[model samples]
Target: MTVVNGYEQSDAEKKLNILNLPSLADEAKKIIPTGGYGYIVGGSEDEWTLAENTKAFNHAQIVHKALSNIDSPDLSTNFLGIDLKTPIMMAPTAAQGLAHSQGEKDTARGVAAVGGLMAQSTYSSTSIADTAAAGNGAPQLFQLYMSKDWDFNKSLLDEAKKAGVKGIILTVDATVDGYREEDIINNFQFPIPMPNLEKYSAGDGKGKGIGEIYASAAQKISEDDVRRIAEYTDLPVIVKGVQSPEDALRAIGAGAAAIYVSNHGGRQLNGGPASFDVLPAIAKAVNKRVPIIFDSGVRRGSHAFKALAAGADLVAFGRPVIYGLALGGAEGVQSVFEQIDHELEIIMQLAGTKTIADVKHAPLTHFNYAD
Candidate 1:
């Protein structure tokens, strides 16, 4: 079979039939209504950073060793006491119900089937308990946007710990909303009840519905308050949306367990540096005191290699898994990772690496950009 992009596939229904990233993206674009796709796929106003995130990877190339006697590449890695067959994990996303009927549960099931971990968004359609049950207690992490009402965030943290979440990601990137022409043009909104407003806006969890929460946080929380919330969570806290080494150092100083470098899939503030551009600095800031995870513009498995080379302990996908879920629920989710593993295995062999640890700091070059 061939995709709309004119790429041939391995078969009709299986994931191998998806020849490339664009095919998967096309499938997702079809699954989501135009309005929703705007938010899921669109970049912020001007979209410079969104475009740069993917382009930044282009500056670097994965060098291959031709005759190193490489056998099978063990993609396995450990996260929070659980052994993951692949270092890949799904980034937290809000409102899976907006994409499919099964919602986060389907995504969780998909992650479980692949022997990977998933972080459930605070604004998820499936509540924490329901999502955990769907994965059958697979290693799951909860992503938090500090609520405007400090007590609400504390309550959420308590709930996450009670639910036995393996990790907590403090999502600190979006203090304010960025304009996506698609969201504005289509008038897209979340489907849940607006606690006090009529629109669906994604934000800090202080307001009732996502929209209001987002709008309120844009005005309420400051950097100092964020540091306080870091002191509150007992579970291993990972700070997501961290793009600068200074912020990375600050997070570590604030008692963060790990630094998750992400650009919000380029959905937030345009012209910001790509996650890769700052990964090395951030990794150094943590100085191996904690693990560092990277995300944004990771369309293929090879990008994971680049991230690993750049000192990221792990790499996560933001939209690819969502695209798969939008296409065929759990099956689609499974297919996305299958594609990743298949490509990753090939790269592992090409690079003469036998396991995730075998991937070393050697045999790579940092791409240079002329100003």
Candidate 2:
């Protein structure tokens, strides 16, 4: 066995083939426990938004240009003043310990290995300092769920600053738990300790349902809260879970340095519009006021390319990374990113785009579809 990011990887895991990002979930399902797997993959209610998130990408087709001297297209870009080797980033997912023993620590190391960014969730299984140490100075963002207690929020922000986090992602949409029927069917409960929340938790929540824990969070989140967190942290605050143009503008007005366009991976709202479907309007509304980060059903390189054309400064994903962690620990996670990065390079070269900026201006044809 070899130790990676403080987790032991067996010889078999080291040799696991993880070339495909979408297929990793199947391999992971075999290893992760039933309840954990359900929680990771299941979406809210009917999962209509979940299915539509990836399907929406099909509606926007890239208009490939011919005869451009583009060889080895560059995928590197800067977001919120941080340089990245690839525009691809990891979205903040909670309770990573359900996927791997090392959890966010392994994820940080994998993202660092590939020169990518990771947003550690406020409810992460590992503490901020440990996750930062595992990254060894890789650019990272701390995603805040915003607890009901002001003292807890202040303490969390202080820890993030001490850990050298590059930014703060304030998630605002999931004030309550979505009706995830899969969890209901399987009677799922968070199995591992959320080190980040342990200090603030009122009591041992090992037996609490996801809904009960979510109920404890502050539900009356507003623009003032955004400004408060940004002012407190003194870091770039990214408002995550934004899907509307009006909400995008409101977040910016409330002192958000960046706007994250996501629908909680269709995990929060069941009947909502696909995150990609709403990107163009939000992008137009924001009009470059701040950087825009997008996630939700972004599975392929072509998907990322389309999102860039539609108006995303950076593209991120959550489930695939977890699956990678479940399959091969940090190395598996690195392979998932490497595969997408390689595919993106190929798509960029073929599409005659030499840089990420070129992709933004690349023409796209939208196909009409019935809602």
Q: Please report, as a residue range, the 10-residue window in candidate 1 with the lowest summed lDDT.
A: 4-13
Model 2: CA > 4 A from native: 1-16, 202-205, 369-371
Q: Using alpha carbons, what is the TM-score of model 1?
A: 0.87
Clashes of each: 3, 0
Cα deviation at 40, candidate 2, in Å, is 0.3
Best model number under lDDT? 2
**Which ranges of candidate 1 are over 4 A from the true structure?**
1-16, 192-211, 218-233, 367-371
* 270-346: candidate 1 lDDT, tens digit per residue: 88888777777777777778788889888877878888877887889868787777776787788888888888788
Clashing pairs in 2: none
State how far residue 338 of model 1 sits from its true place (Å). Answer: 1.1
Computed on alpha carbons, the lDDT of every model, listed in order, comes to 0.74, 0.88
Clashing residue pairs found in predicted model 1: 148-206, 201-211, 203-214
Tens-place lDDT digits, model 2, residues 21-97: 77878888887778778989999999999999999999888887789977989999999899999999999998887
